[model samples]
Target: MSFCNPIPIRLKEARKKAKLSQKALGVRIGVDESSASPRMNQYEKGKHTPDIGTLKALADELSVPLSYFFCEDDISAELAVNLNKLSLSDKQKVLEITARLIDESKKG
Candidate 1:
């Protein structure tokens, strides 16, 4: 069976949650801001597929795991909503706590 890539959908959702314009995301990923708009539009419309490098760049720019682009269902939507609800300070706090938890787990 063939599988479809979910990167386009997840990219759009992540970009929105991050409150970034396509141009902004593109620039962050090393693409020209002007080109980023159309490219991102194509991605969201499922008309273009980004390569692994672009996917990694997008994931990094959006502060999400690369695996996030391949989530199989509406879980991405839930994550987007939850992440969007956080203030920058709250998000930083969560990241700090998560890092500490990971370190603690590793020690145990």
Candidate 2:
């Protein structure tokens, strides 16, 4: 079955988390200031999808990884944000811990 698109929701969440207005985010990503709000609103509403390059710019401006936009679930999305803040070594540690947790869950 096909799944609903999650990019719109993720974009809105990241924008709000960054404490930015749609107009402000649009301007930061190089949209015309006058049309910024409407353009950003369209993206958030799923009326328009940005190209890959534009999506990358948005992800950078929002301080999230490009993969964050593709996350399929809220929990994974939130985890992505937190994971992005960790050092490489710390990230590896988290991966190890999560792997063990998964294995334990499978055994239970």
Taken over the whole model, the C-alpha lDDT of each candidate is: 0.83, 0.96
Q: Which tens-of-lDDT digit does each residue in 19-80 have in candidate 1? A: 99988888888988769788888888889889989988898888887777887677755665
- Per residue, candidate 2 scores C-alpha lDDT tens digits across 13-102 of 999999999999999999999999999999999999999999999999999988899999999998988999999999999999999999
- Best candidate per TM-score, number? 2
Q: How close is candidate 1 to the true structure, as a TM-score?
A: 0.65
State every prediction's TM-score relative to the real structure: 0.65, 0.91
TM-score between candidate 2 and the true structure: 0.91
List ranges where model 1 is wrong by over 4 Å: 1-4, 76-108
Task: State which candidate has the highest lDDT.
Answer: 2
- Root-mean-square deviation (CA) per prediction: 7.3, 1.3
